[model samples]
Target chain A: MESLYLAWRYLVYHRFKTLLLVLSLTLLFFVPVGLRVLVQQTALELQRRAATTPLLVGAKGSSLDLVLSGLYFEGTRPEPLKGAEIERVQDSGLALAIPLHLGFEAQHHPIVGSTVEYLDFRALEIEVGRRFVFLGECVLGAAAAKELGLAPGSTLVSSPQNLFDLAGVYPLEMQVVGVLAPKGTPDDRAIFVDLKTAWVIEGLGHGHQDLSKDDAAAGVLKRKGSQITANASVREFQRITDENRDSFHFHGDRSAFPVTAILALPHDAKSKALLMGRFQSKDETSQIVVPSKILDQLMGTVFTVQDYIVAAVVLVGLSTLATAFLVFLLSWRLRRGEIETMVRIGASKGRIRALLLWELAFVLSLSVLLAAVLLLLTASQGGALLRHLLLT
Target chain B: MIRIQDLSYRYPEGGFRLLLPELDVARGEAVALIGPSGSGKTTLLRLISGILLPEAGRIHVGDQDVSSLSESERRAFRVAGIGLVFQEFELVEYLSILDNVLLPFRLHGRLRLRDADRERAAGTLQDLSLGDKMDRRPAHLSQGERQRVAIARALVTEAPLILADEPTGNLDPQTKGQVVELLRTKAGEAGATLLMVTHDHALLDLFGRVLEFGEEEGATTLVDREGAQ
Candidate 1:
């Protein structure tokens, strides 16, 4: 205890030196600890999301790309399989096969065109208003709503994939009819739209101006609105409403329409194996990918990198310890006269050495405390940022 | 009691050597050692206090042969037996004067300080007219005040032997007399033998016995210690 008291007095007397030592030591430890936490936290988060996604079947070009596009709705656009593929998967007596059509964005958030059943599949709940009921209506994820500041009755415009393709699909202004609860997943950054509305956005289904009443002489035409003025030049209805609900139609074979991928969950292990066998092919038309297995391979790479980081941190820690020891030795050497005085005053050399150790222990404890605080701050907020940039 | 027989000590580098044939001081005696600088007056005091061992002979303070003990054992013996005052007034600069006085009591197990120790330390400082400066550190004290603090620390332990080496070296004449008087009074009260080395012959009348060391010519060394070369 007397050793401790002397140590305390010395540290308090040389406060600036103590602070400098603590700060340097803390810098030496915080970075590695923070990176380690980020790696573990991200891995656990990614694995949890993969478990929720049972299996994803898409074009066989790249399984990684297919999984990224299908699960996150953000990646290279995969070759679209015919809609009948989803019907065949459903007919196989397997589990449900949910279709996804994602090739557009709104206010920089992915606009996912999927069925209402997808919501029930992901166990989502509406926090405000109801889901889409009309052709061009949409629902908002929690983050998307918070970012765009849109509630139930706001309107937003969908952006196309290729701006230079003038003859391709144009922008569609859809009504935000609902908002989802915050789920801390990639779904929280998407705009949910009906698959048919996605087809409408693709220019496969649309409502054009009627030219049945060719009144070239009168220079006017009667429309859904009670009154009609000039400037009735033919154009598309950007929004779908009950007044013109019947005017929308698709052109050709609906069964052969394109969808990006299909997310299927089998009922049992036997059924899942059967579905895998059905999609197995050496040819590169399409393939089945179990996201849980694929993510194991993905995280394997992450673990290798984590191992290297851990090794480098170990080396840095060793050198830092050496530096700290050298500093301690120099300080002790400077106090040789003081130590001699202490010995002359009946203080044993062992006792004085113990006092020095106490001083070092106090400094190290403080550095660990500082590192813990930094790790906690990063752990609390890293998930949101990672999901936004990588998952979403 | 202090006893020295056929004692001889020399530096490893072939420098000045000290050879004391025989000396003895009875308990509770007040003796003064007067000599020019480097005549081995302070060296003899250190050998008697178990601080430096002789190469040839033994020094016995009380019943223990200080030269025969290991370095650590000698330290414990010295802390229990002797109180020391020095020229530079070696008070720990960071500690308050009161804490410096109580330091010896806290450094070892047998001399562990308590409330009674605090009261005694306070009483010693009060006797030196330094009770009000107890909370002031050594840096804030004057030279005379710092010397008084050193004396208070020495006397607070009530050890059997007190050794002072040029304790008045940095003080004015008046302050020097006051410091010497305080040391004499405290050592007499504690019934401890007092040994002091000083150059001032005017204060010789204050001691019961006075001993002057031999001249510098009789002390031989391979190197001229006084020369710059």
Candidate 2:
């Protein structure tokens, strides 16, 4: 009890120095802790995404680019995989392939063009309206819908690639056929579409002709009653119909359009190994990367920086601890004459030592508690920002 | 009872020495050590209280050889049996008068401070005429009041031995008479052995015995004299 009183007296007597010590300890405890929390949660999110899908086959190019562009929603526009690659994987009979065509944008959001199978495997739920069934239809994720105020039947014009896109080469008005439920992942920020619609938006396919250009040229329009061959070959599928060919944006065959990446489930690790071995680049222009390995390597570098920060925090924390000890030591010395008086008044040496130690322990315990509170606040703040960054 | 046999001590730096061939203090006997300055009176008082150990001989307090005990054992013995009053009052400046008085109990972890203990502390304060100043810090007390607080602390412990080093040196003659009378009455009531060091010869009449010291070339010599009273 005497020691406790001494501790309280010391703290109250040196209030300013105690405050400074708490501040230094708070910084020492929270800075690196926050950084570690951010990095660890970010890596966990990336790892979770990576774990859901077994294989990613795209263009036989940089798998890191494919993972970044396809899975992480980062990186520049990737070189699209050919539709023939899908057929090749299907013919291999060792995997279920989901084609992803990404390159077009709608109001600054990337339009992810894939098949219905992709939606099923990704477990996306339609929150409003029906799924896309036509050429000009798109489905918006929750974040995209909320940000753009887009709902069912809302029409959205695609933003062009360049910031100043006066020429408007990629300007296609798409109707919002559905809005997706919130999925706390990168899916929340994307727009989904059918492969055919994606191909049409990329200027690869077209619907039936609405009119004849000959009659339009003669200033006589014909609609509803159009005469055309119903069994036209795939080669005749152009982005513009006969009547609107003059307004066609791009010239390409329907089957030969570009896609960003293809997500493939190779059934097992053996197949994954086989698939990866099949796609190994003999040339420097193409390479296959395991997403996990690449991520681990990236995180290794990130963790190194984090280690340095943690080390610095630990060193500073130790110094602050020393400061606290030094304060107690100085106070002990300052009160020596007083202690001697106490001894003269029948105080034992053991009691004096006990009082000193009790005071030190009391200060240390309070500072530790304060440090813990600060750490919790810092962790939660940093966690929220990271969650927003990764999910939305 | 306190007995000294051939006690001798050198300064910590070995530049000077105080030597006592023999001395005896009886129970209920308040003796004053009268001397000129630098006569080793304070050193002799410290030796009796176990604050300083004698280098060459024995100090027996109630048949216990204090100078032969280890430091820890000596500290325990001192806290339980001896009380000391300083000339400067040596109170903890940050502590209140009550706290200063009760410090011996606090340090011994015997801080029951129950109704009886508080009553005893209050009684000690009342004896010194310091009942109204219990809550005041030592720094706020006057020279005379601070001296009374120191004496109250020594009495509060109720030890068998009380050693005073120039307790009246900082007080005026009126306060000095009040303090000296308080000490004689309290120590006598407790049956404690009282030894005091002082430069004023007039204060020796209150004690039964007086010892005088002289500084020789290299040693302090002690002589005993019965007080005229």
Best by TM-score: 1
CA error at residue A22 for candidate 1, angstroms? 4.8
- State the local distance difference test value for candidate 1: 0.83
lDDT by residue for model 1 (B111-190), tens:
88889889999999998998999988899999999999999888888899999998999999999988887888789989
Deviation of model 2 at A342, angstroms: 4.9
RMSD of every candidate to native, in Å, equals 7.1, 8.9
Runs off by more than 4 Å, candidate 2: A1-45, A56-262, A266-289, A306-392, B1-34, B55-73, B88-99, B109-115, B118-149, B167-212, B216-229
Residue pair clashes in candidate 2: A80-A259
Best by DockQ: 1
| C-alpha DockQ for predicted model 2 | 0.34
What TM-score against the true fold does each predicted structure earn?
A: 0.71, 0.62
The DockQ-derived docking category for candidate 2 is: acceptable
